[model samples]
Target chain A: MLGKIKKETAERWGYMGFKSLFSSGIYFNVFAFLGLVTIAGLAVGLHGTYTGYHNVYGVTRQIPWGVLISGYIFCVVTSTGLCLVSSIGHVFGYEPYMPIAKRAVFLSIAFMLGGFIIIFFDIENPHRMAIYNLLSPNFTSNMWWMGTLYGLYLLALIVEYFFLLDQNHSMSRLAGLFGVLFGVAAHSNLGAVFGMLHGREFWYGPYMPIYFIVSAMMSGGAAIIFFSCLAWKIDRTVLTRRMERAIMAVCQLTILLIAIILFFTFWKIISGIVSPEKYIAIQAFLTGPYAPNFWIAELGFGLVIPFILLIRSKGINTNLMFIATGFMLVGIFFMRYDLVLAGQIVPVFHALHVEEYSSLLLYTPSLHEISVVTAGILIAIVLYLGGEKVLNAHKFQKHAIVPPGAFICQGCGGIHYMKEGESQDDALKRHHRMRKVDREDEHA
Target chain B: MKLTNIDLEKLIPENLISVTKMERRAFLKIGLVITGVFAGGRILSVTSNVSEAFASGKDFVDQYPYKPHYSMVIRQGLCIDCERCLKACKETNSVPDYGYRTRILTKIVTDAVGRKREFIPILCNHCNDAPCTRACPTRATYKNKENGIVMMESKKCIGCKMCILACPYEARYFNAERHAIDKCNFCWDTRLSKGEKLTACSYVCPTGARIFGDMSDPDNVAYKMVHQVEKQVWVLRPESGTKPNVFYMKATRSSPWDLRKQDGAR
Candidate 1:
């Protein structure tokens, strides 16, 4: 098995890189150079804030937290969902998803690495973030839990990926499952950061965590489609039939979760109307200054368009899948922005609180804030592409197809050569019993 | 006159109250002496209790035990939003440009009518049950136990923005550049630590609209203001159950429903 995998890796990457090094080396180098330049520019700009100006923070007293935190949370939640979906496919007895398992593990690490970069920039004091969380833990705080869990999630993913590479299936499966659990914990805790706030009338509710989790799955589903298409574009084989079935199931779940999101959105708007604490702000969102962004950007582009595309596609057509995924990704970004900004737009001063919905305490992102958010996205893309290139992290074998001869049980890699009287179940049961007997015989 | 061990034992009342049914007359004579000594001891204890209560209450009233670190406890009715407090704070602290540490929040009641448009200077309340302190994940925001002042260490903050949502007074401000939370500290570095007068806002108020002193100390300006005025007070959002220390004098039903009260039912 080790020799087979190493031979395959050498064939795929060695040929690809040797060919690219001569023909497309300049193209690859240009992208690599651009990535380096972007990082350098970001570092320089951030460093210039030492002149006693508040350039690093996109916050003011009126709107203290800006886009950076919201974006960071979005990345982390998305990464968590990816890790979970991938782990279920790889580590557990979910044989249907086995073909895509390796790729999933690889992507899980890449996405999490992307999340880490965003968080690193968001913290005011990054150096203390590591030691402080351990030495002086605030167990009550959701952010602390989110941070700690994400850290654990990262460790699990790395372990899971490496063991798979080493062909240590038992350990890999255990690590993968552990990663999934921690990923869920981390994602939900991040959502709870907003949901647990009692004073912010807009954010006070039980739904934010659900909203975050489902949206993450939606983005995760879209991300899989996007990445899978990229795989095909680069001439990698189609995923195994069983893995494709699992991806299809995720697509259905994605649609269902989106429907749930719609229901929550409607009720959320209604609750805002009735709540005395939030009524003024609710009205502001409906007909006030934020109405355009709330309606056009968040609801129209993010929700409605993506919903229509996803429902129409039914998870089958590759082109539709790509289009739907793109729509949802764009929409999710808008949704995050609207969620972050709308709550603070309404001025807190009661006397100044307008009777009718009017403009909010207006704010626009500063250049520094924009640059930082852009940097986060760039980091995610660059890391994902680089990981794929180096690892030969193809999720499926070249031209992987369900040919007539492909009816082998993934559990034992045995071809189902059914005897005249035997049923599928009987074959499976016999296989299971035989394997156990053989193990006992070896021990005896 | 110094009693030895034998003399001390004799002075004690242990043998004074010996009783036997046939010796009742003898017992009554001993009982009288015992009762006399016991009464003297009771008087001494009662006097000590009174003195102890008085001494503690005096210090409590003087507001010697508590101090504000970063937050100020505001009295709403006393404020006219003269902007003098704002100006004074800006000038004194060399405050960097972002938002005011001490700023005024106005609530226009009944169509901004002259009688109904209420403006109160809002800052950090330094609450006994501070929501920010409770929500902070790092324990970066803390309450000073000795003086009941809510304090924050900016150097330790991660800027997650959870405290902004948890604060009832909307007291927390974010330093955009530093990515740290910021708010008023009642001029602790300048005023409170030095045993000086009230903060910049209090000192600037010509109408004595904002009075500052130890609310714990009855002799202090804060204690007297609250006691003497007989004014009804309000907290911005007590429904949060933060037990805010800041009082809004002459507050009415117009104030938002207490969040702490509403939350308790849940």
Candidate 2:
């Protein structure tokens, strides 16, 4: 009975079939290897859990958050970004943006799941957090809000994806709207988790929330382009002309957001130098131990080099875009690391001028921590690959056949009339073109 | 109150009033007499020598919200690097070897002449507006309604360590055995709950360095010491704006050790 239900569901969803996952090929070998690494990493995390986090993790009383926190941030930031960027096309109805929407939604859920897995290991009493989060919710806590909102956002994303698979555009659009709302709120709260800490001078301010939202957009734009490019490389049929246009559009957005991030970084450094408490942490990034991470990874790859490459590519060169985004993903990972660690390197009592706390505290991620972080990245990749095979590369109908009484315009929310034998795709394109002409005429 | 015998004229020149007005005002308000000026008067070393115990202004003593407002007052200068408080606290709380419920921080002034070494003993400040309590997602660590002691519900702790990062004072540590964060709870569990008047650290302190009592009670020594204007009473990291229950004041050699005797008699 279960087998029959599974087959029926698979047939309805247009799954490529489970046999595709088991087929012998380079992709299969790669998937198997990633599965192995993920298992091995999870095993290491479990070992850490069994042996006490204190013994396995590098985090001390001074530096309570470590690389695991950064890893989790990296995953969720990308997930939020994906949700936001994809919503611009699907939820809000931009035709060029629509091509990447389905895959982006799937990847967003995958990345968020990766984030959850990492945090599950990082938290000492995950079971307690689950119970008390509902039983004794602290409304004032940014952590609580971030966790709860992200959980809801994930739910919205899953529902949205399910409806999209069913070709139920209106329901999918509604879910996507909720997903976007929850994603933004959750991401900003994650920033508040760091920003609201008055004790950590480096992270304290309104800057973190704003930065988080803006950077998530930047991260999202780069991610969609990167993964979309990878998807095209994996299978030639996946890259439609519309999808290419969508990647180009995202690439342009990525460039603009990167410039904004660069501007934010410049002011952050200057302002940090002026504040006595923040100066110590900023100094660490400038010329202290984290200088390499800041100069090479965060500035060079995260902002500068990617900015130059994307500009040179002019959102046209797919290969260059691919390479630039790969560099960006790595750089952004370091950016999160620097953000979390630099805020904590200066001991809390450093201002007291005590002999014991005079110097900046140091932390190096343990082998166990590295393994857990590795697992998080692999989990996202493995899920993406699995999603591709199961969801038939997340391809949708070129032109959705609008059901009777379902032809309301997505752009203006007015009823759209289709002329004799006019397809939904052509009607959308014509309407958008006419709107563009009207906008241009108004500008003239 | 008795003035110290150290000749102020010999230590700081008569013309040392060239110090900044703000510095002078701060010194006077704290009842500290300037003892040494160095680095072209950029650095000032001060010692308490007030003969009269000034009545604390009403504005300085805010109405306590908690009935007991359990508090600790650290006599900074009197601490002589003695680890009896540390030893006693560990024994009472069963603190692990790697962790400390309370600790003494040493500050050395190379330029100062008379007292070069000062030890500051620090524990959980039990701040009225504690960042840890605010940051805690599960309300695992919360301020007690009755006494305002920041107490931990260990079973509720998820050990995300957000509280540790939020704390301005590096007071808390994750206790692996309990699978929760632990810190000084003013000996409420081990001593105070059992009707002990003093915490183990304060009771074992040789020089009355750690004074534990109710800040809300006007008759309590902790309340009196914090309320009085005779000495420089300050909390660590005041800029953090935690409004900590723990207070600090200097204990000069000239003042006889009457506070310890008073507590011992009790």
Candidate 3:
């Protein structure tokens, strides 16, 4: 299988013609394995009868919340991030990103699909929730808005991707516009879920919406780079110098975002020091049970290290960029873990401080929960890879590339040939000859 | 009526001291009854004169003031932020796994000492005027007429997050898994509807700090305590006058006091 892929990669690189990567038996086996894992995970998750753990389960009265919430946040946050990057690239006319725009759109859709699956496993009665959200329509609820917006956003992304695939630029642009707007709404609402929780000191406040948006943008950029680089490597294709420059710019933006995130984080911790209720939360992240997670996973691995790697003025090294991305992904996972766990680690009755508190108030994700997260990640990779492979199968190459020539037009600028190796001057001459031939044929 | 020390001593002999005390008590009662009858008519007239005051205000048992029956109230001071109540409520109520019925909030106040300190507790003040209900487009979350508890029928929720924004105190939570709104309802199903005295929070309170009772019934433990304990009390984010049912005898400066403070924390 490795030899075949290498041969195919070399052939594709030499422009000798590419094969259907997904059609191979080896690819089928990987897909089958992923499907099996998903099924096993779902079975384990559904085997439990209780929505929350009791005395028999790992979660105790000391820690009410567990890993499920963090996983859900992870899926949704990634989806939001993908949507933002895709929309900005396609709709905003970021000319540098034109080559990757369609792939980004495809990724946006794939991420949302994965997110829905994760959330589906977490729900106690998904069917009932579906029926109720549509039938009952609780307009006042934040979750309601989030659900509605995500649905619409997904639809918009789908439309945009299809339009792009079909080369319907006008329709694609329209869909992209709507997708961007709804994407913003969906992510902001997701943040409001935590922000509106006046009860959780860590989650409360206006900055939640802003934090979510900025993080989404940063993560989205990181994802695009990571995935794009991977695709380029797999296909043995070098990105055009222009495309590489754009990727560099994206890396710069991502670094700037990390800096902003750091500033906000510093302020967040500092403010926590002043307020008693939130102080407990800050302390948990700073030096409590989850302190190691915060220091190492979120700060050291996710932000600090990634920041150092990406902030170089000369530009990021491609290999180092991938490493940083891996670190950020790992770190972000921990950040989500800390966000959910720190809030619940401290018991409600710490005021009395009477009981001998157990340090094991901590919870590890059940096999089922971990399986669900794994399924989401698998789904994203498989979907993205499969789609790219299929498109490549259909992407016929030109023997010789032709550069565009400038021409005057009334409504828009130069109308160049959509097909490769075709010049506008040749097209115009061909049109005139066809017209003259048609006149002679009519006279005959 | 003793005429003098010598005369009184002569009238009430040392042997008859107990009997004399009983006789005087009877005489005092007789005098009180005569005055009560006359004062009853005067009190009726006074009630008529203070009709507006009577209409708006109920009489206080002592120097303490009367608090109205708020639909959603939280005892912030007594809350220990254990989150047990949130879990119990979620399980008993079948709240979505990724959601919460109540949240534990913590506030940090930095003082001139240049060091930071904090206070934390669970909060779900069933407000007398709930903003969540008002913000709902479909009215999925409604205040119960029976106990004034705000209940949400998940089936009807459309997953619009408007209510989350409307809540001034940020009491609402989004069940991302279920795609519905979930929040504390004073344990209406297992506790309030069953005529149970208190919620899980009040039950799990090891210090007996949280006292739950009918505000209308003066004899209720919560009512009596509020009146008896002359401690300074406060409400979370007092500016959002939703008239929360929950009261705190003493609120910390570090607590989330308003939208501004909440924003600052984030």
The best candidate by lDDT is 2
Per-residue alpha-carbon lDDT of candidate 3 for residues B64-121, written as tens digits (9 for 90 to 100) = 2223242223444455556676676677767776556655555444442322333234
The TM-scores of all predictions, comma-separated, are 0.75, 0.86, 0.64
Window of ten residues with lowest summed lDDT in model 2 chain A: A397-406
Q: Candidate 1: lDDT of A261?
A: 78
User: What is the TM-score ranking, best to worst?
Assistant: 2, 1, 3
The interface root-mean-square deviations, each candidate in sequence, come to 3.5, 0.6, 8.2
Give Cα distance to truth, residue B102, candidate 2, Å: 0.9
- Give lDDT tens digits, candidate 2, residues A176-222: 99999999999999999999999888999999999999999899998
Measured as a fraction from 0 to 1, the native contacts recovered by model 2 come to 0.90
lDDT of 1 by residue, A29-118 (tens): 855875785586467437634532255555655565567666676577667667666655566655455555666666667667656666
State the lDDT of candidate 1 residue by residue for B1-266, as single tens digits: 65564665556464436545658866664554333233322211222222232234433332234543222345555566679988888777556566567667665567532356566677787766566876777878887877777777776787666677677666776665545777777776677778766788788888766767666554665655444323333445544555455655543333444544555656
Which model, 1 or 2, shows the larger TM-score? 2
C-alpha lDDT of all candidate models, in order: 0.64, 0.85, 0.62
Per-residue lDDT, model 3, residue A82, is 67
Top candidate, metric DockQ = 2
Q: Candidate 1 vs candidate 2: which has greater lDDT?
A: 2
Q: Which residue runs does candidate 1 get wrong by more than 4 Å?
A: A1-53, A56-58, A236-243, A351-359, A396-444, B1-78, B91-94, B106-118, B159-161, B174-180, B218-221, B224-230, B251-266
Q: Quick one: ranking by lDDT, best first?
A: 2, 1, 3
- Model 2 residue A221 distance off true place after TM-score fit, in angstroms: 1.0
